[model samples]
Target: MQQCYGSIIRRQQHLIRCLSTKMQSFSMSGLEVDAVSVLRSLAPALDPNKHKGQAGKIAVLGGCREYTGAPYFTAISALKIGADLSHVICTKDAAPVIKSYSPELIVHPLLEESYNVRDEDKQSISTRVLAEVDKWLERFDCLVIGPGLGRDPFLLDCVSEIMKHARRSNVPMVIDGDGLFLVTNCLELVSGYPLAVLTPNINEYKRLVQKVLNCDVNDQDGPQQLLSLANSIGGVTILRKGHSDYISDGKEVKSVSIYGSPRRCGGQGDILSGSVAVFLAWARQLASKGEHNTNPAMLGCIAGSALMRKAASVAFEDKKRSTLTTDIIECLGRSLEDICPVH
Candidate 1:
């Protein structure tokens, strides 16, 4: 019995050593992704033969009465960055407000809040909402969830169903803002879904690490912890937003360190989620044609981060300390043009 216990202890120590070594390997500085090359490579050629929607069609599932600007920022950013069609599916109350923000967006007032729906109507309303979204689900190239989406119980339940449907259809999804809230609570929705990307800010990332890893955030080994977190969720890619965005999809880690403005604006993250959705859609398109070998999520993340930083810099150059999210959005087009010219 003594000998057996000793052997077991030895095996446990060996396992710990192996895990430590693996973590150390991942702790090394992340590889610097070539944002410009990836952008140019994944960018679809401007062809006259392509129809209006051929470039990309993105759907943003967010927006509530209290916060309409977030989804608006996300959806509009997609269009500004060259996506041909952008759609916003928000609550009935938020629909008009979001629509008022931009006529270019196709806004659908489909989601329902808890205050409006009685208990008995929950099932039927949820079903009807899903059915309505189903008609357009297959047409979208990507979905961005959780912009100004308030933390309404009934509404989140509906969004959860929508996420499941998106997964069933194998559609790519970028979860941010309130979307991260839903995903963290119901991790099963994205577990093992490589097509899903989670963009979490500092606070959001901390919560994610605590919930997923059963511990506090460990910045000392951020890349390794992020790797573990992504792998823990079945290889879903996570883009940890910060001074330098770190990206990991369980296979590798990359960072985008380009200098952005010091303004620390509020809607910047919404822009990133929207930008990522479009770039990811483009990356997936190129990959389908055998144009690139890396995962579309990584390319999308790197490109989106690079573009956001460049736009921020451009906006700051003009607005100085008074820069706003709208200012950054305005610069997205010019930054893309400078990065990849028509000629």
Candidate 2:
């Protein structure tokens, strides 16, 4: 009877251990990070002596005749999220429209589509485009690519060159929307660059797996797959956006699953990309100060995901079903204050 009782207790202990491991794995599978703490750590402290542009200088590299709203949302969001200077590099047709969206952004009309240039002018045009972007590239702390980028072959070709230049300068980049489409086809642009971050939505995540791993996405082993994809891409960080955002840097996987709204509205991704850029800049600064050895991309993704979810939740509370991207953008400052409290 004593032997049988001891056996039963041992089995129960084993069962409890298994349950605990499974629960941990499930939590790590989604947006599961110490997001509030990360946000507080990444946010720069207020200082009276800091100069202008000391906070961050961010660039948005997308805008076409058809899609101006995306770049505008991205650039403006960076400013709202505490970036000091925001710039937009876009085609001549897109420059004026994007400029009209706000006087705050430094809008550059540099990019040209194939339809507008003669075949003989292609070489010169490409050279000029590179020159224009090169003059401003090194000054930027981070660049957000592919917001409203259309699928024009000529335009994408120029953007390909721009990506190479950004990689050469070792400047950090956050790729999203059409940017993912471009990088998915040509993996070499960001392959092996630690500062590069790719933020992909559900469909974008599926396509990335098919392109890089040559297989379908496995939700059951999502974290492992995300780690593999980041590893396969030469250590570039990936933030797989979904019901919960999963982030990986080829080293470890983390998730940030707090404060979300069920609205599923469009343009939220743009807000996230913009917010990520600012936090990434801050994280890099903190890393430079030797505060922590954490991956800046990973920290940026966690904070950005958490902040966007918080703002969305706040917006939804007020407007409920009517909450739009603009409404959420309006809540970013308040949300950040709630979490980190500047004063």
Candidate 3:
């Protein structure tokens, strides 16, 4: 009992310090955020009295037969970054492979691809998929809606239904990978939902701009263009990933130019998605407690961008040219510790 009380006290003290630290952090026209400080403030304290799922419960809604590594990277990275529980809901063909990657994840083989289902079965199968996801829909703090998610029409349709359910449940989502592909074509999936965050790389961002604003990518007025996209989508946050990460939730924009590695690896974006989901969950908790007034989605993006970049930088420093996505994942814990040490 004494230990438990001590842990609570320590947790409260940590948050107090985090709050004080945030007040001192600097920004310029809100164009840049103090990402390191925001990360520290958003990350909850390590408390012994906290039980399982108290830290966070994250779900990754992706993984397919052709691409298992991306989901594995996303789920495991969430676990490594301090989420208490991480789950993957994927097609049956990909579930075993993702499960084999790590026993830490609770893998659900619930989704169906077009190839496996008949036209008559698709309607029934999609209903089953949504039902299965709904069983645990409200349990997750956030859903990462794409990491190995392929562009199968049937699969994407089911995912679209799942998104509607999650939004109805008020569950936050970090969308990336082919999930962007789905949202690009069907803007209504995330159109007016404030809890949705779209993390887009160059190509994805280009497509989104073209689809939404009816124009090409504007590097000259990138910040304003990003703001316009977010506003047009009804305040859903967008994290435009590049040499420098830019984030906006229609109301405001922020940038993180922290130095990351030059290793243009395929799976780094997966790490960002998972990291953003976890941090977004934490940020939401902080907001619910009235600890911070900033938008949790915006805060989550800033912190995730900073931490991912820092981890990539550390991994590159150690492995240089040989740095793989796994190497960057390995660095998440240490990089976060460097920013916000456990008390």
Candidate 4:
């Protein structure tokens, strides 16, 4: 009788343990958000009394001879999304073309590529480039680095210096395109900085995994790997761009799978970067005011990804197979109004 009673107690304890574990898992899943709530929490109410630059001041650090459209897409998207000001810092050869894309953008034709600068003058030219960027760096709410940034050695070097300066001033950075290339190579530029966000597409994510984690991309355990990667980089947030975007800031992983378009246009990522920059600035503003609980970078990524997907969907509905990046950009304001009206 005693033996049977003991056995029953043991089984009861084991069942309780199993139930507790299951309950913990349920709790964790509950903490995972719908993402739209995050967007709503971060988006500020538009007040007519608000002054210029209150919405945001965004800067794009890219554009070169081979790639002018990318920086233009990024800068203009920020404006279309209601940023008070948008600036683009690009190579002189690319400035006029990007400027012509929109007169609203402040295009700085100060950056120089390897082909344009003599080897002996590289150091002095780089210094001048950094000086020009430094003057306006502090005024920027967020900097979007590497949209359409060519892999020019001299230009990359200058960007590295600019990133260092941005970090020192505690300005948040949204790194994409060739900026990912620069960060992947150095790692020191953004490692451990919570304010830094890396938005990497399939190939870029793979390279980042290989470079930082020193292993191949594991799709099955992608969330875990991404969590590890973000932790490995010292809490810097990463938005792994894919059919479904996964975001991590070392502590938790969240996926934003809402409202993505079927179109795979080239400049959408650029749009995402710019959008992320604006939202991040707003999120940071909220954080500084002690209003929100989530990590600002994570919130920025969620809102930016959700907004971009909605815009893409709206654009695709209108243009179908002919939908281009510009068409999608043209729909940003309307999409935002549909979700959270600005009145």
- Which candidate number would show the highest lDDT if scored against the true structure? 3
User: Against the unseen true structure, what C-alpha lDDT does each candidate score?
Assistant: 0.93, 0.93, 0.93, 0.92
Work out how many backbone clashes candidate 4 has: 0
Instruction: Give me the candidate number with maximum TM-score.
Output: 2
- Candidate 4's C-alpha runs over 4 A off are 1-32
Q: What are the per-model numbers of colliding residue pairs?
A: 1, 5, 0, 0
Candidate 3 lDDT, tens digit per residue, 70-148? 9899999999999999999999999999999899999999998999999999888988888889999999999999899
Candidate 4 collision pairs = none
lDDT of 2 by residue, 271-331 (tens): 9999999999999999999996899999998898899999999999999999999999999
What are the candidates' C-alpha RMSDs? 8.9, 4.4, 13.7, 6.5
Q: Which of the two candidates, 2 or 4, achieves a greater TM-score against the reference?
A: 2
lDDT of 2: 0.93
lDDT of 4 at 198: 98
Give the TM-score (vs. native) of candidate 3: 0.91
User: What TM-score would every model get versus the actual structure?
Assistant: 0.91, 0.92, 0.91, 0.91
Off by over 4 Å in 1: 1-30
Model 3, residue 329: C-alpha shift (Å): 0.5
